[model samples]
Target: MKQIVIIMIIASMLLFTSAAATILPPPDLETQGILLTTDVSALGIFSNNADLSWRHSSEVLDANLNLVDIVWDPETGLPVVDPETGELIEIWELQPEPPLKYDSASFEVQMATVYSEDTSAQYGEIAYSKNSMVDTKALPASMSNVENDRIITYTGLNGNRILSKENLMLSGAGTPGVPSALSTTCAQCIPPGCTCYPAFCSFVDTGSKIDMSIVSATTSGEVRNLNKIGGGDGERWPPIPSVDGPAHMSYSIRVAELSSSQPSVGYVSTYLNLENSEAGAWCVGIPSLMQELSINERKSVDGYVSLFSNLVNYESAICR
Candidate 1:
């Protein structure tokens, strides 16, 4: 009877241990991804000769962060008990997680404008302020060689200057019949029927400004999942990983002629290109306005009235 009772107790204890093991589930392992979008808009104004006009522009951006790999804690999810130490000995450790991947990331900018007068009647020009890029991971550092090796120079009608990759300049000559300053060296050399105007419309040199923001994933999807998995021995589990911070890109334009025109619109766009991939994002900022002005004939008589509409389009691409 004593031996039978002892055997029964041992069997009950074994059954209980087996049930506890079954209740403890394996560590959860599911991959996840992140998506983000941002948008902004503003109003601008251009005025001259007591005439005022307003314009509007807007921008939008989108980004996607995907998981590519994960690394598991060495002792968190292991099987086997050590008889000597009375502790669970780790038999196999999970492999290290792969690097985080960025996919389907893109940014776009669109703009529209309205004016009280026809701006196209007069000669006008549009140009980008500058170009800029920012990344938290210093990824641009790897492409410095490619960027530094290339330089673009632009020669305008009156003079030449380095043009920003983000900006486009489209300008027209002065009034067709009006003599330009470049036509002759003498200020009085104007023909009997010709009146001299500046070589180009002084209003053609307006500049633009832009501002932008963005966010991206820096860790693998598997690592992000570890934070949700609760049960792990304090000694074997690793600290939870944190998410990456947002990145920023911005630029501005400044010209002497358009110095007084207040810029109400700031737009920024960006994209993350995968390794050996050709994917990229397209961005554009366009400002439109109309101006009504009276041209003086012979510098005295009221000349024919004309309306001008100016549409300036700035475009660029982002690839990472």
Candidate 2:
């Protein structure tokens, strides 16, 4: 019962408020101070109730006796169990619980949005605020390296409506290299014996079923072959130039238009002669949105669209 009383007192400290006590009030001076025992059982009593004792001091006088100072262990709130021992002794103390750490990211976006309204004043105040930039860092130049390294590769159905690996094949002797120049023969691989017409790198809107075309034209065909993929051919191609190729290959590929709606989807359209085994205009890094549109469309609108969209997303994600 005594131990229960001590626990109840400790528990009460936790509640914000407690109901009026119906239980009897603790003993007062009129009842005389409790005489604590030497045994641990009696010490348990001091541990529970208000077992503090008082010593008469030369302070002030009460109604019938001299006023006394109620004593407690100077180090702990608890009273010592030994009644006769006058010297102060230590008692076990309880520590208050620590407060929780708050998360700032949870509120950063909302605060930033509001700050944008009144740029100078509001932003200045935010800057002066305590630890406003905690955990955030300046934009790093090497995030580009991280993004490139994080490029995810996907493998499934090559997303291209026409000229996809599924529907095209090569005609020239082995893959085109140095002296060979780039060339390919088109055939509808989807339906065996369906002779292909001309090849188109991108989409084409034809009113009816048509044959895919195949042609090859390279301005510096004999000059830009490096790494000897095409052997010591005509003038050695000049370092397989990039988009603004010093010497570019312009070819018209005939593509089948199954439907005007389901457009092809992929990356830039260009014949790749990296490996001698597979040489054709293949998409880079997983198929992109470029595969669906015509080559002209990809070069014009799609190029700008990709560039601007990437810029916007990058700014939003990192600049703030």
For model 1, the local distance difference test gives 0.18
What TM-score does candidate 2 reach?
0.11
Which stretch of 10 consecutive residues in model 2 shows the poorest summed lDDT? 107-116
Against the unseen true structure, what C-alpha lDDT does each candidate score?
Answer: 0.18, 0.15
Candidate 2 positional error at 119, Å: 52
Badly placed stretches (over 4 Å) of model 2 are 1-250, 254-256, 270-320
Indicate which candidate wins on lDDT. Answer: 1
lDDT of 1 by residue, 168-234 (tens): 1111111111222322223332343223111111111122211211101010000000111112222
| Regions more than 4 Å wrong, model 1 | 1-247, 257-320
lDDT of 2 at 30: 28
Candidate 2 residue lDDT tens string, 57-123: 0111121121134457668876666657564444332323121111211000000000000001110
